[model samples]
Target: MAEVYQRLAEHLDRLPDGFAPSEDGAEIRLLKRLFTPEEAELAVHLTLDREEVGAIAARASLPEEEAKERLEEMAGKGLIFSAETEGGKVLYQAAPFVIGIYEFQVNRLSDGFLQDLNDYWSTVKERKEPKTINQLRTIPINESIDSRLEVLPYENVYALVEAHDRFAVAPCICRSRAKKLGKGCDAPIDTCLVFGDFADYYVRTGKGRHISKEEAKELLVKADEANLVLNPTNSMLVSAICCCCGCCCGILKSLKYASKPSEAVASSFIVEYDEPKCVGCLKCVERCQMEAVTADVGGVRLDKDRCIGCGLCVSTCPTGALNLVRKPDRGEKLPETFFDTWRAIAKQRDAA
Candidate 1:
């Protein structure tokens, strides 16, 4: 059983997000908690691409019916990824640890599981490697951008919402984990949004409820009002958007440790402060998740490097002292779609 889990860990480590081994073997412990020996063995044979039941069964050397049942069970347990086509054909695939397995466990977390994850993440943080691709990218709220500036379709939160037909709202996994540990904020818990096929999967697995496009837009507005940062999957074809808070979100909290949060995140814009129009109300200071705005003797100070261009400060500023501007050197173009994003990450990891 332990050997099977070890093999599964190595398989996951090869993924783009990476399930790195730890000195304490916490990663293996996490896998033990999540997968049975049989499931782990089957998972090792799976690839990133989705496959039909017969194809997967042949690859695993299992009977077609047995493989189908096992795949369905693993998918329900959030141990792997599965999708049903319009013609009612089912497909199964491997999922990475971060954006896939961990996020899928939103509705099924326990105290023991949380502790194991924390232990694993502690080592992961120390051994972090520089990557060219981020799984998620930051985008300012609709009200934060200047009307005159040209915002790409992917950069516009409203446009992204409008592009999707199907939507689902799920509990923010980070906030759920925080609340379970008794250390989260008062922000709304059900702010995570999934779209299209991801939405179908979430709804099928009972992790989230189906919501209409209008409802999704309304939720985005509410999240904005609550001062949550909007981070969507880093692809032109958005699949999900996480409305995150600094107190609970792992990505936002990691920014606190970064010397330059702006450079650490993928964002097209940065906050530009107009010193002359400033007021001492300190609204921006309270709204900033990155701690980029602080009270100063004159008014409030804006730290450009610390900002992630969330636009929370700009949306609520009394005197319009803050505005978002496009970065002069916005790096490489975003991946065309979600699969493309992961493919690029996998290629980069392979080269590294």
Candidate 2:
């Protein structure tokens, strides 16, 4: 196995556009456990809808039976499978970590990338300052799905803007991601919230504005040149933005510098903790991306000032120890903004 791995390593004299093939990293470690070196190598080579036997022949020059057998063996290991709808054909892909490793160069970052990005975060993005949804103007971010999600901002010092979009359907790709401790990331922006349909997002709901399809394409090109990855799913262009905590959506596990939500992203809302019913199980603390909870030999503590008021930590509590309270000054109640925007846009877009 080591010999095969070494042999392949020598072949990768250079990486693809901003991409590294595979090696011993968190992602590669995951793939290595799931596949043999030969299979893994082939896994990277197979195109999305390409045939399994042809892909192996192209990469390994193996005979049909051998390649087919190997592909089936991998299928047994869940390494390969036949597509049901798109192609009803055998195709192979690298394992999760292998794909993640493939994403790493673009998703995660190295040390030098992090330093340069941090510089951009503080100087250019200005994410640490509190923000208002009415004033936010940039790309138009929209989502199709209404389940839990997070939209990380790019202007804050942290370079990760934790947000969620509440829409449920999408016509493009599946998901977007944030800068995971690396290069080519948007400067983290202060977190903000979006609600209603697309209208309120540009007005009172969130920081970003709706983008034209052409503009959205331009943004993707811009991110490409900077080596940044947007929602591969492109849901942002289809849905509204949300502020969420770690206990719920996938992003905003933590703010980069502050243990709690930054002053900028903190909700115009707050979460109150009832110590009398609190069991001190550390669940809230674990789920609070804001780190608003603390203990000092007494019981769990909720720092009202630190809570962004996404109300996530409260949802998971066992003893009914928490609840979310709206902050009157935090953001605007823009239901009219939503109706006006959606109506106007629908009128214009549909009329056209």
In terms of TM-score, which candidate is strongest?
A: 1
State residue 71's C-alpha deviation in candidate 1, in Å: 0.9
9-60: candidate 2 lDDT, tens digit per residue: 3322111111223322322333344458877655555432335577667677
lDDT of candidates 1 onward, in order: 0.90, 0.38
Q: Give stretches of model 2 more than 4 Å off.
A: 1-119, 122-131, 134-238, 242-263, 266-268, 329-352
Compared with the true structure, what per-residue lDDT tens digits does model 1 show for residues 167-247? 999999999999999899999999999998889999998899999999999999999999899999999989899999998
Candidate 2 — worst ten consecutive residues by lDDT sum? 167-176
Sequence-dependent TM-score of model 1: 0.97
The C-alpha local distance difference test score for the whole of candidate 2 amounts to 0.38
